[model samples]
Target: MPHDDDHVPRRRARSVFVDITPLRESPAFAKLWTGTAVAQIGAQVTIVAVGLHVYALTESTLAVSFVALWALGPMILAGFVGGALADTYDRRRVALVTAIVAWVSISVMATIAFLDVSVTWPYYALAAVNAAAATILGATRGAILPRLLSPQLLPAAAALSGITMGLAITVGPAVAGVLVASVGFPWTYLLDAVLFTGAFLGILSLPTLTPDGPRRALGLDSVLESLRFLRHAPNVRATFVWDLIAMILGSPRVVFPAAGALVLGGGPITVGILTAAFAVGALLSGLFSGPLGAVRLQGRAVTLAVAAFGACTALFGVVLLGTGLIVGPGAPGEPVVPAIVLACIALAGTGAADNVSAVFRTTILQTAAPDDVRGRMQGLFYVVVAGGPRIGDLVAGGLATLIALWAPPLIGGILILGIMLVLVRTARGFMRYDAHAPTP
Candidate 1:
């Protein structure tokens, strides 16, 4: 009996580290992961480039923030329509088609930048189009994952996604800052357009993944059905609510430009470093994510992670506040080393915590939801994921204009912490949620 118990403990110990079995076992998953990891680097470059470009053109933080605002409506619509389509059609085809559209949009942006159009509206319009197509691609690709891998591997897959995201944000922004400063914005956009092809290749290699259950026609009725299902699914609904609260309150990307220019000061390079710092934390966390998969109480984990995220975000705000007090406001061309270091540490903490929350949240959604409605749920999930940041952009941008640059995050962080506590306490079911027996 003692020897048998020792075997169980050994197996449990081994389960603490990230399981790469999914990648090794599924060729399709490997291709998808590799392609996405590469493509996302380009995507991050474009994201940072666009913000820097807009800020350079307009010199307005509000204008830079509007990039996300313009993309919001189209993204929400795409999430709904594309998710429904993913459920009704072959997800692989859907992803491929949307990837082409995104590629074209990025190509157009490159052309405009190269031509030195000097107008900001075109950039905003093209960005919206790109965002819409990306949202669809996101929805379709998310729905395709469960089909490609086993349920038990979903947590590991989510951890891998953290690595993908972490690497993309970490490397892409740092590179984009250099490219924007050296070669300029047009080249940055062009690089993304070329990199976008990796996603296409990945999708192309995927086996046709159609919905598993009774097929529902893609239309208003199908969308309505998905919404109805979401209405009753308390645990899943809690995930969305908690995530939205955290993002809307704690999202600080909109202010990175302002932080670099007016606060932290190394110009575009500072923005890149600040952005990359967060991903560094996430990347490190993912790399060491051996213990996360073995945890059974996913809900409790999410709550704890998000709480940590809120605290870190609040600390970030404080760092900015200290910078302003010590270094003084107004754009100083040179960087403040101490403030930058402190801010980076705080942002890294936020990244680590957020990644942990994301792993569990994604695992819950993929495991609990049935295949028939999974696409639609994933679509809604995409909307929450995408829209929350935009809303934060608006909140941060609008507030910063009225108050100090650091004010929005300071207030928002406290709000996130308070709201999340209330939400978790009220929703008892969510607190007790178990991965082995998921409740959608």
Candidate 2:
């Protein structure tokens, strides 16, 4: 009895770390994960480079934020259309084609940068194209995961995906910062173009994945079906709404460039560190995600995680406010070491909380939605995931123009907490949601 008891506790302890069984059990998943992990780093670099480049040119926070705004419309349309196509066609094919298109777009971006094109419009147009293609690829790839792994291992898969994202952001932005400061913008963009080839390999290695149900034509009817399903599925809808609340109110990324230049004063390097801080938190959380897989009350987990995210974001805002008060406004050449450290700590906390929310949210969506409509659902998921932050960028940039730089996050964080509290309390179904008996 003593030996058995000790074994049980030991097993429980081990379970608290990330489960690697999914990687070992699914070779295809392993390839996809590895390839994506590498590719995303490049993607992150480009993301930071673009913001820095735009800000360098226009010297406006709103201009940097508009990068996301430019891509938002195309992203939404592509997400819906891609989801329908994923249902209608082989998911592997859809992912592969889109990956190619995205890769090409990145190359075009690099070419423009390489040729020393002074025009900014080409950058925006190409970025929109890249965002649209990526949205489609993301939707298709998300839907394909279930086909690769068993239902029981979905949580592990989600956890692993979190780790991938964590690694990407943690390394990508930091690298972009150093590269942009050292080699200039074209080289930074070119690196992304080179790294993007990994995605092609990942998609090519995957086996064909088709929808389990009868083939649905790609059009308005299919899109309407997904929307109709979402309308009735309060739990799933709540997840979407809750994420939007958290992202729109809590995201402070738009202000990072300004914060680095004017508030914290380390220039691109400081901006990179600030961006990487959040990813570091996420990476740590994912590394120890063993306990998360065992969580049955995912709805509650999501709520708690998002609440933490809001609180941390608010703290970050406070740090920024404090720094602004100490330094006053206008670009400072010297760095505020203490304030930067505090802000990074807060951002890291926010990242950890956001990753936790994401793991649960993704698991809920994949498990709750039926296989037949999974593609469409994943498409919607892409929209919320991609569009929410863009919307936040707009809000943050616009608010900063009127108020202090730190106001958006401070005000937004409070709104997130309040809104989420009301949303969770009223949605009794979500609070009581059980993973084993997922309802969508």
Candidate 3:
């Protein structure tokens, strides 16, 4: 209930996702959105695949997180390249190229999963490659939107993206877990390969979108220029930092896999259910999110949504605490829980809350940032939005390895709550982000 959105007048805004808003009414935008939805769903499949594979191999949560740990470097590289490409070349082409790369990476992963490859290092390598390519596609996709949709409908478009996120996270992961459990990791991953085609078609079919920035010929200099622009661009800088702090401290995804095996007892099924639960919350939020489409103060929206997210994490930690109390703390190899079914419900609540925060943060970046710098801005955005959660993964993995599995969330939940409060109080511009007069 605690939220920064309380300040936005509770005006009843019309719901638009049931039918295409004027923004996506354009055939190009519809195609682009369809492609993004396909890509998101594939990404979800791979995400669950990686988690299950790691656990299946090592039976260690820490080992699973190494997938995220390895991703840090490639993610950094891909972000820069992808963001720069978004500014320089045709954005659709950039997306296409990355999509191809990601597709190949996932294909390799599928092959390995089918083989039951005992070699863990190769799995990590392939995963990092997949993540890096995904980074490029993700950043450019965001940058491409302004060209696809008119400004008037940007907010609605963003909410629609939230619905996509909801579907990808909720539907994809749930289906993935079932598929992996019923068939195997290879089959789950193969389905992802088939879906990847949708993203390729989506990006390729879109109307040609020319570069808006002064044609700075592509190279190292162009990439460096983006870094420099980021430094000078105060709002852009603030936005990324805000995202970093919010995600690094707040994201609890790292713990979900471990929670499934250790506390919940259902293993991969629990992991998938927990992930889907988060998406459910997000998709449901879109129902009341019509007003968010008309929101003028996005900075406040980010703050409130993030705070709510932190509270949910804390609540998730409480769920862990409850399990520990009921099961009596790792009395053996795995802690026992009375009713894991209810725990999945708690995790789903956490998922929904987090998605609400994502809608606002994404809107801030898409609407506030200029086209010239939007790609790099999105690249940096990925570093945090995509990157911070990985750091949390490492933190969770390492801490879980050293201590009890429950240790990370109890600690992380508190850290998220504290840091978000401090940052919101300090950063007034973000706190005062009026959508009518965007600063970035």
Best by TM-score: 2
Query: In candidate 3, what are the lDDT values of residues 234-353, reduced to their tens digit?
Result: 666765665666566656676776677766666766665676676777787765566666767777677666666667666777777777666664432443444455655655655655
Reference-based lDDT, each prediction: 0.87, 0.87, 0.74
* TM match of model 3 to true structure: 0.83
After superposition on all C-alphas, the RMSD of every candidate to the true structure, in Å, is 3.7, 3.0, 5.7
Please report, as a residue range, the 10-residue window in candidate 3 with the lowest summed lDDT.
10-19
lDDT of 2: 0.87
List model 1 lDDT by residue over 1-440, tens digit each. 37677799788776666678779988999999888888999998998899999999999988987898899889999999998999999898889889999999999999999999888999999999998998889888888888888878888999998999899988897789899999999999999998988897679899888888888888999999998998998878878888988888888887888899888889778876887788898998887787887889888888888988998898889988888888875776589988899999999999999999999999888888888898899899989988888777789888788998888878888787777777677767888999889988
TM-score of each: 0.88, 0.89, 0.83
Off by over 4 Å in 2: 1-14, 51-66, 112-116, 180-187, 258-269, 322-334, 401-403
Give the least accurate 10-residue stretch of model 2, judged by summed lDDT: 418-427
Give candidate 1's TM-score.
0.88
